[model samples]
Target: MEMRAKKSSRSSTSNTSGSTTTTAVERKEIERRRRQQMKSLCAKLASLIPKEHYSSKDAMTQLGSLDEAATYIKRLKERVEELRHKSASARLLAAGSGTRRGGGGGGASTSSAATTTASGGAGSSEEAGRREDDMPPAVVEVRQHNDGSSLDVVLISSAARPFKLHEVVTVLEEEGAETVNANLSVAGTKIFYTIHCKVRTYVR
Candidate 1:
């Protein structure tokens, strides 16, 4: 009976040892797999970052440290934002320049037109003096689009005499322009006229 009891105890001890060994091996395998999965995720993250943002000489070196990879990603985001801001500012500046050019062109045209009218209407030396005193200085500007599809004209003058707006419209129509819109405003002694028109490319 004593020998049987000792054999049974020995067998129990052997079984427990074998079970402990198996459990230890399984735990080790699980830990190894977890580490491999983490490494794969880090590699994927590093690949997504731009090469310019990497601080290391070799891009692969950045993947070795999680903190470095994260820093590169942050820098990439900031660079994108800075580029976006610069693009927006450039567009705004271009728009402002276009507006100013349109306004200046209109003013120049109006002034030229007024000068030509004044010169041609002066038939006699005595009449020239009277006409000059009666007619306010006029400015007219015509701006054509790059496509040659449309034009905008602006006229500004001091109301010295009865300045006819219809005469200007008639001249535009004769020049093969279809009036789209016309605006006229009188402020004190000043007259402002803005006309939007489409130019006819072919005679129809």
Candidate 2:
């Protein structure tokens, strides 16, 4: 970074004078500017120091008198603030036009999509999760043999819910669940089955 700064400054102030080297006056001015730049850089670095740092009283006593340290710190802080003010003023001066990002200085930049999206607010993610939970459990299939029987009855009946084995079996029977075959399972939940129902069907 220092090399880049030096190179830029050197290029900005070319030393050429009828093919001769830089004059003493120009060289002196450059050195003076360099010192000023270094002082400004030091001020910026000093501002980053945390305020109100603590040290053990015994350690501080061993190091130096608190009064002297405080004086030094106050000077550093004042210098940093002065430079920050200067930088802020320069920025304000350079900002001739209105604020960009398609927004006025005090106004927010909002897209049409963002304005229309009241549905997906703070509760949207939770609502989506709840919708997933509310989805109906899949209808288990139960195929029947020549003799009327189905796995559907056994499956729903075993569930520890409003539906039980006997209750579900009754439902399937009422629904004309016939040509019943066995059910399938995974770990615990009854997942799949194959059953042929009567021609007419109605949801309970």
Candidate 3:
């Protein structure tokens, strides 16, 4: 009878230990899965921010490809308007035709020309808009993919945090730019990442 009791006690202890080990293993797996899920969420969220558009205004004007004659005509139109504004036809030359600067609609006509100082109003506002249209967008294309194969992208990201290397990789991949290599640097309060990627040709 004592032997039976000892055997039963051993079986109970063994079963309890096995169950405890199984529970520990299950808890560890659950933790790993949770971590993976959280990381995935972080990456998805990071990919939404847009990249800064950087370019020179002069470079954009060159892209317009205006013919030389058309460019000259535009210059002539602006000059005529300047002359009209100053009332500087040969008739108003005594008022000081102001040595032909030939651009920028003349500064306010001479105060001595017997005219009150002009104040810009709604007409000036519209004229300002017209002048602004001549300015180019902030960014220009430094490179573009071939016509048979190209990709474009927009992204949004959290403003509060700096991304890890892998996180940035995830974002670029999402943009369809596969990463070949990366170089990085740090400046006060900012991080700069440079990436090199091969352009893909879509044969299909």
Model 3, 31-83: lDDT tens digits are 99998876665444333322222122332232222233245456666675444
Return the TM-score for candidate 2, rounded to 2 decimals. 0.19
Query: All candidates: CA RMSD in angstroms?
Result: 16.6, 31.2, 25.8
Overlapping backbone residue pairs in candidate 3 total: 6
Supply candidate 1's per-residue lDDT for 198: 87
Off by over 4 Å in 2: 1-136, 148-162, 176-204
Measured against the true structure, the TM-scores of the candidates, in listed sequence, are 0.40, 0.19, 0.26
Ranking by TM-score: 1, 3, 2
Q: Give lDDT per model, in order.
A: 0.66, 0.42, 0.44
lDDT of 1 at 144: 62
**64-121, model 2: which lDDT tens digit per residue?**
3344356567778667645543443333222211222223422242444445567664
On lDDT, who's better, 1 or 3? 1
Better of 1 and 2 by TM-score: 1
Candidate number achieving the greatest TM-score relative to the actual structure: 1
State the weakest 10-residue window (summed lDDT) of model 3.
Answer: 94-103
Per-residue lDDT for 129 in model 3? 51
